[model samples]
Target: MRGTLVATGVVVVIALGYVLSCIIRPFRDCWVCDGKAHHRSKRNPKLSRPCRWCRSTGKRLRIGRRAWNRVRRVQRDA
Candidate 1:
């Protein structure tokens, strides 16, 4: 009974870790601007400006991704 309980606990922890990883790994870098946050202007071809999608941060996280991070934090704290 003791060994079974330990095994179950380990499995639950592993499953949670997997869930967190899956939920959080998809938003590391901006995909639209290719992490550069800017591209040569189409009209001028020589000037560049902040990417509209990522707002020039070069790192973009979706709303769901942000929420998942919060959930991960809460779970980790618990």
Candidate 2:
């Protein structure tokens, strides 16, 4: 019982931290461009193209923030 409690507490803390992070910093670097907003061509290093995933913004909304926004939208519509 004691071990289970400790494990649950750890999980809760981690979850809270992630929630807070999502609130404070809702956007993270794009995985494809790594915040550079563009990617170099494989054939020619000099040529580059804007990142499609982030729409050349160099950032993407966090999954947690996206979920929160979805929930809010549903609640508002309901």
Task: Give the TM-score of each candidate.
Answer: 0.44, 0.88
Steric collisions counted per model = 0, 0
After the best TM-score superposition of candidate 1, give how far the Cα of residue 68 lies from its true spot, in angstroms.
Answer: 3.1
Error (Å) of candidate 1 at residue 6 is 24
lDDT of each residue in 32-77, candidate 1, tens digit only:
7888889778899789988888898777775566777799999999
Best-fitting candidate, scored by lDDT: 2
- Local distance difference test, each candidate: 0.79, 0.96
Report how far residue 24 has shifted in candidate 1, in Å: 7.1
Give me the runs in candidate 2 sitting further than 4 Å from their true place. none
lDDT of 2 by residue, 1-78 (tens): 999999999999999999999999999999989999999899999999999999999999999999999999999999
| Model 1 weakest lDDT span, ten residues long | 19-28
Candidate 1 off by > 4 Å: 1-18, 22-27, 42-45, 62-64, 67-78
